[model samples]
Target: MNDLPFLQHFIVLPVLLPLLAGALLIPVKQSRYSLKFACSVTSTILLWVLAAVLLAMADGGYWPDGIGVYLASNWAAPFGIALLVDRLTALMLLLTATIALAVLVFSARRWDRVGIQFHTLFQFLLMGLNGAFLTNDLFNLFVFFEVMLAASYGLVLHGYNLHRIRAGMQYIAINLVASFMFLIGVALIYAASGTLNLTDLGARVALLGNEDTWLLSIGVCVLGLAFLTKGAMWPLGFWLPGTYASASAPVAAMLVLMTKVGVYAVLRVWLAVFGNDAGALAGFGFTALTIGGMATLFFGAIGMLASQDGGRMAGYGAIISSGTLLAVIGQAGGPVLASGLYYLLGSTLAMAAFMLLVELTERIRPPGAALIAITMEAFAIEDKPEDPVGQGIPGTLAFLGLSFAACALVISGMPPLSGFVAKFSLFHALLEVSPTEGKVPGLTWGFIALVIVGGLAAIIALMRLGVRIFWASGDIAPPRLQFSEAAPVTALVALCVMLTLQAGTVFDYLDRTVAGLAQVTTYSERVLGEPPVMRSPQRGLER
Candidate 1:
């Protein structure tokens, strides 16, 4: 291991260490506390490694943007596990580690209540997430996905209460279907392409004939379905709110990583495997982007409008953000990619932080109240039941106002925050693609105007709701937050502050990341040898 090159080993360690630690925790005495300690230590180290990787990526420049680092047991592509760390992969790894840390910190109290299995399951889930991000092989991506999903099944159903069970079952069923589709997609892809290693496939996919092209189309569709399902895309996302709503705070926070994995896979595989060849497969790439994205965006917005429950509302918002991210990706060019990177980092961090806040609110509720009110009725519980009466409604309203404001800023892509940066960049991208200088024709302008209008509507709606919730008079009493519970919220706020202050640095980092991905030549050379024959005939034809 010591003789191995640093770059070859660095990427995989983040995945392997946690898995090994989780396995080690299983048989140890007082495994619960020991597991927690192990996870904390291991995750902290991983975080450092992740930071180092990001810095290295930034420094190394985009010269090798699409370069796939192979960890061959000294074996070649068709065999052995390979951990690839391209710009996108590196960014996702940092994000996953960041969120995992926050979730773990928030879960400290629940860890005491839930027992050892929660920690073990969580570690395993993280291992799966990290593995998915770094893995170069498509089959192994599916394998990592299943590992995470299986661990998630247990975590979702951890308490095994009736409500949790019901929700968990639905969640499991939906994901099971997705998993099956994913496997079938992989099979179809293998049949058509004859390889599962992403780099190798990218090198060879252009050589496919019409028959293989049709099969590959089906495979891409199936794979897209699986990713959309996991990412909580519209129509397929009906299960997300209920499942996330029922889970413990930490579990819900951790579950966010699942959506990210799906997103990462789509970006990694599509960009490299397809290598900017947008004309392939009867324009399947553009079709997936436009049709799938619009539907997801509309579904998420409608879901948010329809939601009454607080946690569920946030859950829908998460869906909307995911859709927006994908929409930006589908619309990819220079500006859109930059925007997506910014939003992906910012929104995920924001959502993770907000989710942690909601959990804290549950914990700080009145002493006599159950940690969570299981009754189906709309209820507000508080900490210190003896503190006073008639303050609940006001307090709830205040908290709701804060949440709503953050949500507005996040979803609307408003100024002075990360969300705005993403949206603006995306709009810029649309402007680039539009043929008309004053007004673009077709989907480009259509999407631009629609997204802008949607963002504005969301902002207004959230603001109005915030006013009603915070200012409206209701006799309900308020809950209080302890310092420990407040820690996560404070950490998130600190992150927001850092994001604001270091906006320039953040943008530079994202630009570097995008530049890395957009290097078509680097990608072509790495995957397809010295130079790909740019068929001028293929290049000049417009769809």
Candidate 2:
């Protein structure tokens, strides 16, 4: 497949492939669940392969900026359709595909069979995620954002219940307001800066007058509000925990990736448009991002400590992950962003795997069981705990315990896992690069202190939860397991393990990625430099 002539066109395949598959699945009769499932699975597998190849291609450094720009309909940037990919984009593609495939398989056992609508929206949501990562145009990004959100609405409401319905409506309302702000911000941006193409905005923004710059800043702040809302910042993220907790397990897992998409947007826009190259606009929002991130991190840490609900607990874990990434991006210097990206990969995978496991654990611990388990864990019982050798442990229970521990270790940044590696690297980078390098570096101590505290909070919360699920629940029969359901969660956790083993190679790649992103001119030149795919019949038949 890599040898194929059109493989250079692979940049567009992630977006197109899912769109085509989803569209085709729409007409399949509801009774033909098997066929729909097969198509969805096939498309997802193909997407994974395609993503792997794309990541490899970027690693080859074929483009000077490590960015690949594809002009659609023979059009160019700021004028014609454009899609772009750099190492970051390719990495995002692979991450999306990896998680989507896992979640889809996890659904295959029962969730997919419960309804075919989920099957269709599943692929369409993939399409939206892929497009969002690949597209260079802000308008195109908005289109994909809506596409993703639209599918998410259905997914959140998939297994309708009062809790889900209520959460879905609030999710919709918050995002709709965000979308409205996105539009207003874009309009004001165009009025103030004259371009919506990211590269163009980077180049043109600094040239504006005082009035225009002020207007542009307002517009950018507005636009960023939408992303912050999506990114789940404090105050703006009031809707996230409820919405994520209410979605079906597989859908909730996908929402982990969904949350990162918001972070990705914030990362891209903040770097591309407000970098040191933007003159007066340079470093405009870094302080705000830092404050917001620290606040969100603290909020999430406390929320996790306070919440007993499994789903909401996972949601708060995601919030901590987001806060970490947001704080890193706000740093704007040092070698920390790579560490943040690394953390992003691990936390996203771990959180998703944990969310998937939540439903299975719930099967063993009913509402009353959870209450009982908590009581048993918090209060003392007579001696003679279970056999020290664990003689009576069921295989299913053992597997759950191991998987749950792995996820907890990773999410909490405990030792011997990728999450710890990420946090350690982050602290190392921060220490090496002083606060003077970043505006919010003044708050650098705060960030580091909170990160340590946050990790501690996660450890305590997860440890308590684990005891409740495994130890306190009275002797119970092992729940029935399906290969499809169990494999996905196991695979995701393994991926985090793999990340730990291969940290050096992955960090090198991300280091190269951050270096490429630092050179704003290269990205702009790559997008703006591509010659038209064809010219008017070689200039009217050469006269």
Worst 10 residues of 1 by lDDT: 382-391
On the 0 to 100 scale, the lDDT of residue 126 in model 1 is: 81
lDDT of 2 by residue, 1-543 (tens): 223436558899999998999899898897777888899999999999998888887878565556778888867787977898889999999999999989988877477765447788998899999998998888888999999999998888886666777899999999999989988988998899888899888988788999999999999999999999999999788898898788889999999999999999999999999998899999999988988999999999999999888899998999998898998999887498999999999999999999999987876775576568557555533221111121233488788889999999999999999999999999999877864545444488899999999999999999999998888877866665677777898899999999999999999999998998898888888898876645366553110
TM-score of 1: 0.84
Clashing pairs in 2: none
- Candidate 2: count of backbone clashes, pairs at least 3 residues apart or interchain: 0
With a 3 Å backbone cut-off (N, CA, C), the pairs that clash in candidate 1 are 365-382, 365-383, 366-382, 366-383, 391-477, 391-478, 392-476, 392-477, 392-478, 393-476
**What TM-score would every model get versus the actual structure?**
0.84, 0.92
TM-score winner: 2
